[model samples]
Target chain A: MAATDKIFQHGTLGLLVPGLFDGTITAGELLTHGDTGIGTLDGLNGEVIIINGHAYQAREDGQVREIAADETLPFASVHFEKPDISAPIEATNQADFETQVVRDYRLRNVFAAIRIDGTFKTIKTRVAPRQQPPYKTLVQATATQPEFSGEHVQGTIVGYYAPQLFQGATVGGFHLHFLSQDHQLGGHLLGFEIEQAELKIQHFADFQVHLPIDNEAYLQEEFDNETIDHAINKAER
Target chain B: MAATDKIFQHGTLGLLVPGLFDGTITAGELLTHGDTGIGTLDGLNGEVIIINGHAYQAREDGQVREIAADETLPFASVHFEKPDISAPIEATNQADFETQVVRDYRLRNVFAAIRIDGTFKTIKTRVAPRQQPPYKTLVQATATQPEFSGEHVQGTIVGYYAPQLFQGATVGGFHLHFLSQDHQLGGHLLGFEIEQAELKIQHFADFQVHLPIDNEAYLQEEFDNETIDHAINKAER
Candidate 1:
């Protein structure tokens, strides 16, 4: 059986692996699971793009390059997507657009993997810088993140919408990452105003989590749930 | 690899499988994944008890029998557990008991698999009657369910406490089932008053959903989040 046929995830997002420098799962190995998703490179170098079975690294310097098969990542969410619905939408901001999308598509309570491709009036994004050992949590890592804003940025946003009940295991609400069509701009999506775009969602009827079962940090951490939740909210925000 | 080493589940509670009929996964196969959990029998015959790698059929007639390994069930949640913490507690009612458990253990905002064994002052439960084809939703099926109340019932309560974000994937809050020490009375747990009990919980850091991917009803159903949520709440209430 093909491994990538399911929603393959690696590491506990809640357990907080500080950086990707020691990421255990290889890009080549990960690709065996899904062809499209988002993550970061070794050392939390920048945003990661997995599309059409090719992995790309988009850096803070706006330099985009193809990641080698041997390269690894700290965390990622990917799926062998087969969209059940495709539709067009119009909206001005992130909030209104998401509300309209959900209302229009009637996707209130289901797990959905979505891809939106289009032009935007303004796109705001952020990429986490590289890190060293004695790492802090992701929220702390992103506290000093660099922001990018541009007009008429054409890109694709890829992510998922999980029911709020799955907040810890997955972000309960919409979580999206962006990559420019030219491959020069990309990061965790902060905000964007859609000019026109196509919204495609695959009914994600199943989910699975693979943890760093042998990782020392994951095993030792007490994982005070409130602290982790707050950290996740801040990072997502 | 041992299958019981991870949490294993089948079918979608969100899709509301009406009765335990034509269930494909066998008890032997399920035991290969987990040793303890709860579920219903064919045609919603009665409660199912699985513990220590053995399966028991607890029927409406208060008859308990060792389930053949080949017997199947509609829904169940179980894990190969290694509890992170175990302690004692006191509470007077279901709400108070749950509150005390969370407070005493300080379990918040995390997915937890819990087991409590001891004497209960009052144990209240309900079981769905056997259903036929053209089945209704679980909410409808339990509309006229039978309730059983017993004083000083000795049993073990088994279930999970999922964060609100996972409400669709699992019951967002505490979802539990009970099996008496005698194994003659059991079903989905509705309410209980703890006289004295030891609470054991595992930091269930992983989750996986295995749906009846080929079931026609599952494939065709469009779940309305609000309606399903309401139904679940009413049934649990």
Candidate 2:
């Protein structure tokens, strides 16, 4: 129950890259760690965007809905922290925005949580299709996934920025998901151009990973280094 | 303030490998996260072993002493939990012990804290040379480190078992430090053979890493993947 500015994450990209998508912890359980963050739901069902203590799931059909408390999650990152720095940003494109933000704000090596509220000039994203048993690897799932894009959309972008050292366990760069104000569209952010936005970032030095140790697959499976690195780069980047 | 059975660590082997040895968090503050763990003091002075809520430092000259409240840490891993399982062990060599324990106890892939108290048939260890400014990388520092070894030693071994996924973030395998019962000897464990020992382990699904974000060295340094991986494998193994 410590309201400290640290991230609480469930599972890892390493686990998900290999297609172990069964939900281990529930949405209700995840909320205890943080009030704002992002992740995906059970079986990689779309993308998870947590805002203001509420959990929402965005599906591949450009649909958004509040998740049930009991719904489980295979991978997610949550945090409870007020913004340490908030300001208006001018960078538009994804690459430019990331480069400028990390460089200008001195967020190069440490971890941080970012939230940007604005109208995007052009936004493009995709959602993971919900999977059943015999789940496919993330690369395979995203290979034929549906994508959504628009000219002008007002929404919030939320995610965590991990250092380069956490390459496979988490995203080495920003891993963000978007959710529209109207709750009509959004998913994992693939590309974006912000027209005007207020960026709020909470830089923290700590990250807590909650592994699914109880999952039989997690305890028994061997995680090869090259396979994880290659799969994450191919699927997430 | 939550007494959850998770490995709470400060800094990372990635940071240490590059010689960012300045302590960011004090020993007093680290104890709030876990009581039993292992770490190194500020300036990479020596190896740390926490047992029964007390912190002890073992130096290269075969000396052990209680750490002060104000002592700082460059890296550490700690947890507060009663062992889930405790029993006598028969494996002796480092390789055999790690393989058997992980295989027999189903500890593969998950994170776990291991504690072994035993009579050693033979033990070998080394302590970091107390360092100052213009610190050398771990590989360079450990190159000429003073080592200690003996036969028929009674002591305890404490450390964490990180899955291969951790890699340079922590020791991908077992990273242990040893301390003798009489507080007369021990350091970073290089090798050992147990005559008889009792093993205690707590399998956990969570690991919390506390980065030294405020350290100017940590924030500004560009951690190269090839450098970190190579340095860790060369020095730690």
Candidate 3:
């Protein structure tokens, strides 16, 4: 038998200590039955009292008191301490960028990711265009829902920003996008659905806006004559 | 063969889709030769096909693409959202009591069971004692240095409670206890070990704290005190 199996048998014999056996037993037999090898037995004066390396001695006091099973055992007890909760200084890091869009001096893009929570979703936003100042320019802007077709997914805008691209300039505009998921596009390839799906662009009329283009006055009036378009489309039955 | 064995054979057959065996005639013949009686011949029929009670129809133009040996399958992407932060309302039925040396009041004791992040282990907090007016009591506590030893655990006081016991005419000499688990003392018990633990109890030295005299108050207070004491003792070792 394997050493592990022999050890298990010996352990069982230890549990059944002080029990009577039917078979005749010698010192070697007893040691083998207990699964203790010959090397573990200690012989003294041929009396064969010691076995399995432990000395056997008779107690002077013969009488013993019986105890209930529910009585507590003589075991050790210890207290446990609470854990620490402060955030480590080096553990925090900057948020990762999801996506970016750039169109000449103007940029319209959306980015989305998860926080500490396990919710699956994303965020959408837009970046304003850079321009010269003192010219009263008309800017058109519109916000629309996002479109999802065949595994192509996007999100709605919770907020937006219209910062001036040029130094010392103030410009403002509107930004928006529809939010949904598409399954037909197959994978994460972009622009594939743009060619396959019927996309409608909603146009917004010119709106009054301001920006700074010169360093002398640090103020300038500009018109964003560009139309802000947003659209959402789904597959037809 | 047993039903479980038949199910296993069916599972293996399901892995061999139409495109998977298109170029392997030998392998297909070997699989078909097995008398499993749990397979369909037309894996890409235009009409709906049923196998093991599951119905699937192949699209006319949409054919299953053969997966490359080295190519990996695409997985779904997810974005998680942040949690909403809000305060919980305090419990009703608060009362006040007075004593010769110290004052006491009754406040609803709230205990919350919270699971630690990342680990499945659970740690329960002791019921907090909130005192009434004139005591200027607050239970602003935080957990720190939480350590577990055998069955007992210990934690440091990153925070403390001023006037740990409530003092007043309606609620005097009020104490709080935190229990880890409920068990009979005379039954089989587990030993606990602790490295370091401490609770900074700050009370007025001029007044002597008295245990509650009323049966209801006395029993509750006794239970709470004993639980806290036991936990502390276990943790302190």
Candidate 4:
């Protein structure tokens, strides 16, 4: 198949043209006047066109079209592939339920607030959308804390999204914040893994949601409250 | 005021608290509970709490107050100042319009398109934003083309936006694309430049709006028929 057809069939195209910054002609191409009739004559597989009454090379299957000599064409469109977002969740406080519970919740909440806030700020300010899909998302969390607090607590967590998360942004990289309330306690207590659960919408569709395998819903329902309550109730019976 | 308060009031909160990568607090302090905060206490003044659940320190009229463990103090709030946004607008592309009217317009449009497209793509794929502007808005419209296709155009243009115009986004760098068509010569050309721009947004509301000095709208207006017609007429006359 012709380059144009290949691009069309795959919904993508690229060319590593020399002397063009390793230029890759993806699905998009800029076409001008010469591209129209020249293809048939030269056995050129692309389109033809005329600019300022002069012929020029043009891509038959590209999204951009020919412009008059007097008119101008902007870069048309630009985009980059989204990054991956997946990790294991660590349940640090699972070992010491009593003390870890209150401290872990506080740390989790604080870390969540920071991560969400930072990611949102980054996306909104840094990223600019070009077309859709692979919506960019940022996830920041921590499982460790410093020992200066005199309590054996997890560390402080902080994360920031590069481009703030938009309505349909894709997800990217992980920033883990670790903290410990007590100075002496050692080892990774937060031992939970994260699985890619599902992609959904949240905040009234204002944000694209990524539910981590160790999401809050599962923790509260299956692990934390439910498990604890069941154990207590069974013991009473 | 105490050093900590000074830092907070000066709006250098990020600095006062050590960053995740390069922090002031020691690893042992991070792992143990203590009275001293892990990060820098620089510029702090007024009532503050050090160490986890430790006594409070108050700085009033340059005097320091140390609260006892048994003391119960009234509630208080601390506020930090906001950073300045409006700085001098750096002008670029400050060159004499020596080129023919048509080429000038095409060059300007190409420059605008490339800058915007490059920025959008970079932000989308890479999490970092550019630190400087992408294109010099005040391009010197010289009639001469570079000996090399991708080289920067020589000759000085006064009143141009300097350092290229990627003034938005919080991280990464900027990229520029330049397309030039010489109606008098009957051909087209393309080129590019890369740079950086950065912005920090502390709140969600700050991310909702576009950067203040983006020249996109102005560039678009220049591409209108009226502007092109006027330039062409002047050239012919």
How much lDDT does candidate 1 score?
Answer: 0.71
For model 3, state the Cα shift of residue B6 in Å: 33
TM-score of chain B of 2: 0.96
- List iRMS for all predictions: 5.9, 1.1, 34.3, 21.2
Query: What tens-digit string does per-residue lDDT give for candidate 2 at A126-171?
Result: 8889888798877887777788988789999999889988987888
True contacts kept of each: 0.33, 0.91, 0.00, 0.00
Off by over 4 Å in 4: A1-155, A161-171, A185-237, B1-175, B179-237
> What is the fraction of true interface contacts found in candidate 2?
0.91
> Considering only N, C-alpha and C atoms within 3 Å, which residue pairs clash in candidate 1?
A4-A33, A21-A43, A164-B165, A165-B164, A165-B165, A165-B166, A165-B167, A166-B165, A166-B166
lDDT of 3 by residue, B61-177 (tens): 322122222221110000011111222212111121112112211111110111111111222222112122222101111012122221333221111111211111001122211
TM-score for each candidate, following the candidate numbering: 0.65, 0.97, 0.11, 0.16
- Is 1 or 3 the stronger prediction by lDDT? 1
Q: What is candidate 1's lDDT per residue for B1-237, written digit by digit as tens?
A: 544334666654665533325465678887777877766665666667677777776666556688888777767677876787888866768798788766665445455678889999989877767677777677778788777777899998887776544555567678887888987677778898888888888765456767665555554465655665677677655
lDDT of 3 at A83: 14
Candidate 3 lDDT by residue in tens digits, A91-163:
1111211121112112221111111111113322221111122222112111121222222233211111121
Report per-prediction Cα RMSD to one decimal: 7.0, 1.4, 38.5, 28.8
Compute the lDDT of residue A16 as modeled in candidate 4: 5
DockQ of 4: 0.01
Superior candidate under TM-score, 1 versus 3:
1
TM-score of model 4 (CA atoms)? 0.16
For candidate 1, give the DockQ: 0.22
Q: Residue B211 deviation, candidate 4, in Å?
A: 10
Predict model 2's lDDT versus the native.
0.87
